[model samples]
Every structure is written in C-alpha cells, then in structure tokens.
Target chain A: MINRTRYLTQSVAKILIWIGALSTIAMMILILFQILREGLPVLHLGFFLDSPKNMGREGGIFTTIVGTVALTAVAIIVGAPLGVGTAIFLREYTRESKTSRVIRFGTDCLAGVPSIIFGLFGFVFFVIRLNMGWSILSGGLTLAAMILPTVISTAEESIKTIPSSYREVSYSLGGTRWQTITRVVLPSALPGIFTGILLSIGRSIGETAAIILTAGSSLVMPTSLFSPSRTMSVHFYILAREGISMKMAYGTGAALILLVLMVNIIAQWLINRYIRHRT
Target chain B: MAMKEKIIEKILLLTAFSSIFILGLITFFIFKEGLPLILKIGIKAFLLGEKWIPSKGLFGVFPMIVSSFWVTFGALLLGIPLGLACAIFLSELIPPSVGLLLRPAIQLLAAIPSVIYGFWGLIVLVPLIQNHFGGPGLSILAGSLVLGFMILPTIITISEDSLKALPPTYKAGALALGATHWQTIWRVLIPAARSGVVASVILGMGRAIGETMAMIMILGNAVKMPTSFLDSARTLTTNIGIEMGYASGDHRQALFATGVVLFFIIMALNTLAISLSRRRVH
Candidate 1:
C-alpha cells in the first residue's frame, strides 16, 4: 500500500510539472494567435510603406517605424558608451568597497523603479525643466538613463567573467592598466558588451509610457534629434487606448509583436554566437 | 602615458558615478514637485481620503494604494504556484536539451513588452471576462491574469536558479534513504531553495505592482477599493499612466506625488528582494 501511494504521488508530481510547462507554452500560443488573427488583416505592403495620415487614424506606420529606429539610435549612441564606462569602473577600477556597493545598490534601485516613474522624471527634468520639449533627444536621454542599470550590470558581469590569467599576462608584459583593458580585456569582452547593448536596444524599442510622456507623439517623420517622434509601441498604445482606429491599432500591435520577436531572436543569436565562440 | 591613463580613469569614474547622480536627481525632482502638493492637501487627506478627481482638487490615492496591493497579491496568488512548478520541471524533471529550448522561450515571454500584454488583455481577456462573468470585463481578475503572466519569467528563472544552486548531495541522500523522487523534491530540495523561492516571489510582486500599461488596459481604472476579484480597480501605476498626460496645476503635482508613492513602494520591494537573494548567496 505504501509503495502504491509513492507511485501515485510521483505520477501526480509529474503531471503538475507537465501542466505548468505546457500552460506557459500554451499562453504564448494563445497570445500569438490572438494578435495574428486581429492584426494581420490590416498588415500589408502599403501599411509598411506609407506614413501616417490624419494623426494616425489612417495610413501605415512607416514614419512610426522610422521614428522608433531613430530614437533607438539616439539611445544607443548616448547610453552605450556611458554604460560600458560604468561597467568598466565597477569591474576594473575599484575593489568591493563602499562606493562600489553604493553604485550597485543604486543600479538595483534604478532597475526596480517602474517605467512610468522614469516617465515622470523624464517629463519633468528633460522636457519641462531642461526645455528639451517633446523630442527624440529627450526621449532617448530618458531611455538611456532608464536602461543604464541593465547595461552596467551585464557589462560588469561580462568583464568579471574574463579570467584573470589574461590580465595577469598583460600586466607581466609591462602593459599599463589602460593598455591591458583597451587591447586585451575589452576585445575579449566585446561580444558580451555587445550582448548588453543589444538587449538595451530591445528595451529602447519596446518602451512606451516613458517615451510617450517625454517624446511627444507626433505623426510627422522625425528628421533631427530634437524633432518630436513616436515609437511603434507608443503608437500602438495611443491608438488602442484612445480608440482612434482599431484596425490601425491592431496592425501596429501586430507589427510591435513581430518587432519584439525579431529583436529577441537577434539578441539571442548574438548571445549564442558569443557563447559558441567562447567554447 | 601616466597622464593619459589618469584622464581615462577620471572619465570612466565620472560615467560610473552618473547612475548614482541620476538616482539622486530623480528622487530630488519627484519629491521637490510632489511633496509640496501633499503638504498643501494635508497628509491625512492625501493618504487616507477616498476620492481621486484631479479637476476637483481632490487627490486622494488611498483607494489606489489599496488597489495596487490587492492586485499584486492577486497576481502573486495566480503566478507563484505555476512559476514554481515550471521552475521545478526545468531544473529537475526535464533534460538539459529540452530545458535549453523552454528556458529561452520563458525569456522571450519576458521580452514581449508590457504594451503587447496590455493590448492582448484589452482585445482578448477583457471580452472573455465580460461575456462569461459580467462587469465590463476590465476587472482586477484580468489585471491579475495579465500581470501574472508578465511576472512568470522572473519567478521561474530565479526559482530555477535557486533550485539548481542546491548541492546534489541532499537529493542523493534522500533517494538513498528510500525517499521517492517526489519526496526528494518536496521534502528535501524545495526546503533548501526556500530563500531563493521567497526572493523570486518578492521580485515577482515588484514586477506586478510596477506594471503600468498592462494594468491600465485591463483594470477598469475605477478608483475604489476592490471588494472582489471581479471588481474593477485602479493601481497606483495605472493612475499615473492614465492621468499624467493632461494633468495641470496641483493635479499634475499630485500625479508626481503619486509617482513618489510608487517609487517608495518599489524601493521597499527591491530592498527586500536584494536582502533575500543576498541571504541565498551566503
């Protein structure tokens, strides 16, 4: 009887695990199916080619796509160097001291702060107080700050993962700390740093509430850093929430879904390639 | 050469310190703008009052506080069990080959963006709730469901890491002593990973509470205490997401105050999560 009960319990546990895993997969399928069903009818060549017409009530999100790409570009330009710099400092410059602890703690806090709070700060400091207005520059700066923790942590991790043997070899050759970092450590850690940047790119593209509040959502094609622009996520949000055009909203939503999938795939590919190269 | 190295070091240090400065600046800006309004409205009224009309000079967020807690608690209820189960399966039950595939799939779920989740909830879950149960469909249930899904990745990853971190000796000892596979997992492994599992739940709670766009789309955004799972309720984050666009005067500052409240809550949760995870490491 005891043996039989043990058998029954083991089977029950197995079923529970299967149910959990399958449910996760199932939810993904359900979301994908619903999005494709409602969104694909409106997705077409013209939708991708044409700019918004009548404040996004009609027309494709060509301009919106351009805007998203443009904002992400600015964000990378602004965020990457700073993020990498910070990571280098954390990993290379100092030992595990109070300052390093404080920096890490701050980064963790920044990571946990909701995107909307970031939005409020960006709106107040960047847009209003700094007189940047609702522009791609403002939005990009905010996103850059928002994603700094992610980039810094990942970059720091990558730097830490590089075995100390390489650094010791460089130092033994009479190379200065800077020389060793720039030539040996940095090169070896490039792919990992790049992994962080790519992940940040995905984040910058998908961000909405923060961009919506800071980057004024204009339908016009963005031409300059200071020019106001709207992202695909924000475009989808404004359309769906305001009930401007459900068809366009669905189209944009579908496109947003596809964009996220593409970003995830590309990022994963880079990470995998880096891992394979390491091995 | 020494000068050049020194200059590079200084620059790197400056950049490294920027995040700390930014944190201070954000806290300063939010408080500088928000606290005055809270003072003007009186602390008691702002924290304890029940109304939320900006145009009417009423900026009470007590209902929103209640709503945020309940929704997070609800999401935790829906997400933790499934996430823990999934973690166990990935770490113990499944082979590494299958674990590799499903693992990235979970991360992919995390990367899908909140706006998409909100859109799905709006389009699919809301109507399902409405037709099947009642009350315009945008209830706390929908919020919990969507937010629960949003947080699954975080919970699963952390819990799996915790479980994997356990030394295999415990499992071996249990099995050698005639414990069933299920008993080994239930009696031995899960207890050892307790700190990590608790940390995951706390972190998941943080994500669920901080989520704005999805909650805005699903929760009916009604400013009231949720009496049931089906009741429409507004979260603190959703309140800001919905109103920060056009608010003016004290209304705008009150929204900033709303942000202050949110920032504090998230900070607390982050601290708790950090402490818990730190314990796990030790």
Candidate 2:
C-alpha cells in the first residue's frame, strides 16, 4: 500500500513538473507569436528607410535606428576598453588579493544597481551637472557605465579560462607582460571578448529608461555627438504609451524584437564556433 | 621597454578601479540631490506620509513603497514555484537534447527587453485580466504576472546550476535505498541545494523590485495605496521613471530621494544573495 502511494505521488509530481516546464515554454511562444503576429506585417523596406512623421503615428523608424547605432557605437568604443582592461588587471596582474576582491565586489554591486537608478544619475550628472545636455554623448556615456560590469565579468571569466601554459610560453620566449597580453592573451581571448561586446550591444540597443532620460526623445536626425536623438526602444515606448499609433507601435516593437533576435543568434554562433574550435 | 610596460600597468590599474569610482560617483550624486529632501521633509513624513502631491510640497512615497512591496511579493509568489519546477525539470527530469533546446528559449526570455514585456503586458495580459477578473485590467496582478515571467530566467538558471552542482552519489544512494526519483528530489537533493534555491529567489525579488519601464507600462500608475492584487498602483521605480521628465526643484530632488531608497534596498538584497551563495560554496 505504501509502495503504491509512493508511486502515485511520483506520477503526480512528474505531471506537475511537466506542466511547469510546458507552461514556461508556452509563455515564450505565446509572447513571440502575439508580438510577431501584430508586428511582422508592418515591416517593409520603406518601414526601415523613412523617418517618423507625426509624433510617431506614421513614418519609418530610420532616425531612431541611426540614433541607436551611434549610441551603441559610442558605448562599445568607451566601455570595451575599460571593461577588458579591468579584467586583465584582475586576472593577469593581480592575484586573488585584497585589491582584487574589492574590485570584484564593486563590479558585482554595480551589476545589481538598477537601470532606473542609472537613469536618475544620468539625468542629474550627465544632463545637468556636467552640462552635456540630453544628447548622444550623455546617453552613450550613461549606457557605457551601465554595461561596465557585464563587460568586466564576461571578459574576466574568459580570461580566467585561458590556460596558464599559454602565459608560461610567452614568458619563456622572453616576451614582456604587455607584449604577451596584447599579442597572445588577447587574440586567444578574442572570441569571448567579442561575445561580451555583442551582448553589451544587445543590452544597449534595448535600453529605454536611461536613454529616454539622458538622450531626450528628439525626433530630429542627430548630426553631431551633442545632438539629442531617440532610439527604437524609446520610440516604441512613446508610441505605445501615448496611444499615438498602435500600428506604428507594433511595427517598432517588431523591429526591436528582430534586432534582438539577430544579435542573440550571432552571439550564439560565435560561442558555438569557439567551443568547436577549442575541442 | 620596461618603462612602457610600467606605464601600461599603471593605466590598467586605473581602469580596474573604474567600477569602484563609478559606483562612488553614482552614490554621491544621488545622495547629493536626494538627501536634502529626506532631511527637509523629515525622513518619517517623506517615507510614511500617504499623499504625494509635489505642487503642495508633499513628497510622501509611502504608497509607492507599499506598491513596490506588494508587487514584488506577488511576483515572487507566482515566480518561485514555476521557476523551481522549471529548474528541477531542466536539471533532472529532461533529456540532454531537450534541455539544450529549452535552455536557449529561457535565455531568450531574458534577452527580450523589459519594454517589450511591458508592451506585451499592456496589450494582452491587461485586457485578459480585466475581462476575466474585473478591475481596471492594469492592476498589480497584471504587473506581477508579467514580472513573474520576466524573472523566470534568473531564478531558473541559478537554481538549475545549484541543483546540477550536487554529487550524483546522493541520487544514487537514495535510489539504491529504494527511494523513488520524486522522493529523492523532495527529501534529499532539495535540502542539500537549499541555500542556492533561496539565493535565486532573493535575486529574483531584487530584479522584480528594480524593474521600471515594465511596471510603468502596466501598473496604471495609481498613486493611491494599493488594497489588493486587482488594484492599480505605482511602484518606486515607476514613480521616478514617470515624473523625472519634467519635475524640477524640490519635486526633482524627491525623485532622486526615491532613487536613494531603491539603491539601499537593492544593495541590501544583493548583499544577502551574495552571502547566501557564499554559504553554498562553503
């Protein structure tokens, strides 16, 4: 009787677990289906080429695309160096000492700091105190700061995975520490570092709150670093929030989803290639 | 050559400290703008006062705080069970090939932006709730459902890793003793991975609390204190996100003060999560 009861409990638990797993999968598919169903038909050549007309009720998201590209470029350019450098210092230069521990703690804390708080800081410091105004420069700098921990941790993890023999070989060849890093270490760690950069790009592309605060949702095409601009995420947000144009909102949302999908796919490909190459 | 190397090392050292420096600056600026309001309004009134009228100089965030708490609680209530189950399914129940396919789908859930999730909530989830359950649709219940899913990846990934980290001996020993798979998982493995599972929940709670754009989109931004799951309410993050656009003077500072509270709360949760994970390691 006890054995039968145990079997019954096992069957029930198995069913519940399957339900949990299936529901999560179902949620993902449902969301993607709902979004793409509404969003995909709106996509076209003109949709990618034309700039917005009334508020965001009509026209393509070309300007927002440009703004996104420029902002992400500045972010990657600024963030990648600092993040990779920190990783190098932590992994290559320092042992697991007090200073390294402190740095790691700071990075972890920074990772947990909410994006909205970053927005408030950006609005106050970048937009006001620094007088950079609500421009690409201000927004990009804030995003760079926001993505630092992600870049740092990814870079550090990749660097940690580099076999110690590689470093030993460089030292035996009488290469300087700097020479070894820039030549052997960096090249070997390139795939992982590149993957981190792609991940940061994906993050910067989707960031809305911080961009809206520091970038100041302007419809005009930005001609300079200091010019205010809007991003696709922010544009979709405004369109959805103001009840301006559901059609356009769906289009923009669809576009944002496609862009994220592409980034993830590319990142996945890179990881797979790296793994295969290693093995 | 050695001189150049020395200079490069120094530069790298500066970069290594950049995160710390940035954290300091963020704290400094937020506190600088926010502290005066907390002092002026008195901590008690600012934090506990019910009304949040900025024009009349009333800057109470009590409602927002309460809403944040309830929304986070509701999210965890929905998320924890599903997330734990998913984690267990991934770690133990599923075949490797199936797990591989499902894992990326889960990560993609996280990869999708918060704004998109909110948009989905606004369009689909809100209407469903309104039609089915009553209330204005954009209730705390809607927000929780959306956030509950948004936090699934975090909870599942961490919990799965913790569960996977356990020795196979535990399972083998349980099975050899005639314990079924369910009994082994329920009575043995889960207890062993307890700290990690707890840490995942705590971390998920932090994510739920810190979420902004999604909450702003779905919560209906009602300033009044929330009474139930069906009530529309504003959270602290949304409070800042919605108001900071045009707020100036004391009103602006009040938003920063809200940020200060959020900052402290996130830090506390992060510390707790870190310590919990550390205990698991030991």
Candidate 3:
C-alpha cells in the first residue's frame, strides 16, 4: 500500500511539473491577450498624437509620451556615467576588501528597498527639501537612484568578464590604470555596458510610484524640466483606479506593454551579442 | 599624466561612493521622518497596536503588517510550488529546444511593468476571482495571484541556475546505483540544490512583499487583518503608496514609518538571500 501510494504521488508530481511550466506560458499569453483585446480597439493615430484634453478622459497622450522620453533621457544622462564610473571603481580601483563588501551590501539593500520608500525619499529630498517641487527633474533624479543598483551590478559583471590579459597588455605598454580602463577595457565591455543602460531605460520607463510622487500629474503639456507631467504608467493607474475610462486605460496599457517588450528584447539581444562576442 | 590619472580615479571613486551615499540618505531621511512617530507613539503601539486612523491620530500598522505577511504567504503558497516545479522541468526534465522557447516568456513576465500587471489584474484576475471565489474579488486572493505570477521569474531563474550547477555525475551515479529517474531527481538533485532554491524563494518573497503598484490595484486597499484569503487587505507598500500623496504632518510621518517597516523586512530578506547564495558558492 505504501509503495503503491509513493508511485502514484511521484507520477502526480511529474504531471504537476508540466502543468506548472505550461501555466507560465498560458499566463503570459493571457496577459498579452487581455491587454491587446481591451486596448487595441481604442488605439488610433489620434490617441498617439493628441494631448489629454479633459483630465485624460478624452484626447490622446502626445505630451506624456514626450515627457517619458525627456525624463528617461535625463536619467540616462545622469545615471549612466555615474553607474559606469562606479562599476569601474569597484572592479579596478581596489581589491575586494571590506569597503567593496559594504558597497555590495549597500547596493543589495538599495535594490530591495520598496518602490514606495524610494518615492517617499524622492518626495522629501527632491520635491520639498531641495525645492525641485513636482517636476520631471525630480522624478528623473528619483528614478536614477532607483535604477542605480541595477546599472552598477550589471556593469560590474560585464567589466569583470573582460579578460585580465587585456589589462596586463596595457600595463606592459606602460599604460596607467585609467588608460587601461578607458582605452582597452571599457570598449571591450561596451556592449555589456550598453545592455545595462537599456535595462535601466526599461526600468525607469515602467516605474510609476516613484515618478507619481515626484512628477506631479499635470493635465497640461510640460513646458520645462521644472514642469509637472504624468507618465503613461501613472496615467494608466489613474484611469483604471478612478474608473475614468477603461478603454483609454487599456490603450495606454497596451502601448506601455509594447514599449517594454521592445526594450527588453533589445537588451536581451545585446546581452547575447556581447556574450557571443566575448567567446 | 600621473596627476590626470589621479584626478580620474578620484572622480570615479566619488561616483562609486554615490550609490552608498544615496542608500545612506534614504535610510537617514526615512528614519529622520519616521522615527519621530515611532518614538512618540512608542514602538509597541506603533508596531503591534491594531488600529490605523490618520484623522483620529491612532497609528497602528498591525493590521497592514498582518495583511502583508498573509499576502506574501499566500503568494509563496502559489508561486513556490509552481516555480520550483518549473525550475526542475527546465533544468532536468525538458529538452533544450523547448527551454529556449519557454525561458523568454518567463523573462518577459519579469520585464512587463508593474502598472500593466495592475491594470490586467484589475480587469481580468479581480473579476474572475470575484465571480468564482466570491467576496469583493479585490482581496488577498487576487493580490496573491498577481504576486505569484510576478515572482515566478525570479524563483524559476535562480532555482534553475542552482539545479543546473549540480554535476551530471550525481544523476549518473544515482542511476548507476539502481535509482529510477524520478527517484534520482527527487532524492539527490533537489537536496543538492537546496541552498539555491531557498535563496530564490527568499528573493521572491522580497519581491512580493515590496511590490507596490500591482498590490495597490488588486488588494482592495482594506486596512484590516484578513480572516480568509477572500477577505480584503492592505500591504505596507499599498498603505504608503495610496496615502503618501496628500498626507501631511504626522500623517506623512506615519506613512514614512510604514516604509521603515517595509525596509526592515526587505533588508532582512535580502541579507538572508545574499548569505544563502554566498554559502552555496563556497
């Protein structure tokens, strides 16, 4: 009786494993279907081009798209250089010591801090304390901080992958540490570094809570960095939660999903290419 | 040249410290804002008391705390079994060609924005749960379902990596010793990858607990201890996200206090994960 039951349970576990794997695929498809089905009907050229006229109840999302692009641009400009520098410093400037361990611990903690906490930090530090107010700059700065850990970790991993032989060659030629990193090492790790940037772009684009607190939801088009604006994600949140118009929300959701998938695909492709190139 | 390189190194070093600075600022500012409320209200009442009314000035996050744990527990119940099974399927059971197709889907699941998940959950899962499972539908069950899906990628990826790291010899030896295929896997491979699996589950737990945007949508936003999976609940993340907009003075501080609690929970989980993975490597 016990052997028979064990056999049955083992077979059941095997079958359940198939279910688990297939269900993941089914879930992804279901999400895509729901987004496209509800959203595609309302999407049009006007929806993409026109600005929100009545508190996102009517018209398209022209300004918000621009705001997202501009905001992401600022974040990339601020975060990318800092992240690359930090990765270089961690990998090259010092040995793996207590300082590096602390930095790693700090990065891990930063990565795990809830998005809402980051939003709170941005609200107090940027919006109120720094007098940036509800602006794209504040939101972008907040997102930079949030995505910094991802960038640092990825960039560091990529930089680590570059063979030490290249650095040794540079040093044999009497090159300084800075020369070795900039001329020989960074170029080799460029694709991987680019992948990190793209991943951060994806992260910053999808982020809502952090931006919502820092970037005040303004109906009007933003005029400058100091102007408040709504992102597509934040816009979708309001429309869905407020029960404004499910049609528009679905449309925004669909667009946002497409953008994210595109970004992810590109980043994945870049990573693969980098790996192939390295090998 | 030496001077220029020294300057370059200094700049990079400063930038390297920038992330640590940001982390410090976040912890300091949050504590600066949140500690006042905790001190005034006393730690016990703040953490353990069972009431949370901003207008009445009664700040007790016990309900939200319990709700957060339950939701995370619920998510683990759904995510871990499926994720671990899926990890085994990919690493040991399935062919590479099949894994090639399925793996990207899991990664795509990770890349999809939290708000999109929220919107989808609001429109699809919430109504489905409401119809089938009853209640408001936007309850602990719905949140768990969404969170379960959200953590699958994290769990599956790490678990699969750990499983893959095991030597083929282990399986070969088990089969050589007259063990059946399933027995070899069940008894040997799983026990070997235990640390990675635990780390994956802990990391997934961190992801589930800290998730804010998606949780806010399907969790029904009820600040009460849920008696059942179908009951409405609020998590620490949703509590802060929903109220931080217009919250002023002590109310704002109270939300910061909620963030502080969340920080500790996430920090603990991350530390545990790092230690587990560290041990696994050794």
In model 3, which regions exceed 4 Å deviation? A1-12
**Chain A TM-score per candidate?**
0.95, 0.97, 0.95
Every model's TM-score: 0.97, 0.98, 0.96
Interface RMSD of 1: 1.2
Judging by DockQ, tell me the better candidate of 1 and 3.
1
lDDT per model vs. reference: 0.89, 0.93, 0.89
Best by TM-score: 2
lDDT of 2 by residue, B135-192 (tens): 9999999999999999998899999989999999999999999999999999999999
Candidate 2 local lDDT, residue A75: 91
> How does model 1 fare in lDDT?
0.89
- The digit string of per-residue lDDT tens for model 2 on A132-166 reads 99999999999999899989987887888889899
Clashes of each: 0, 0, 0
lDDT of 3 by residue, B1-282 (tens): 989988998888789888889999998889999999999999999999888999999999999999999999999999999899889999978889788767767788888889888888888888999899899999898899889989999999999999999989999999899776778888999999899999999999999999999989999998887899999999899999999888999999999998889888988999999889878888
Give one digit per residue, the lDDT tens place, for model 3 in A22-131: 88888889899979887888889999999987788899988889888877887888988888888999999987888778887788778877778889999999999999
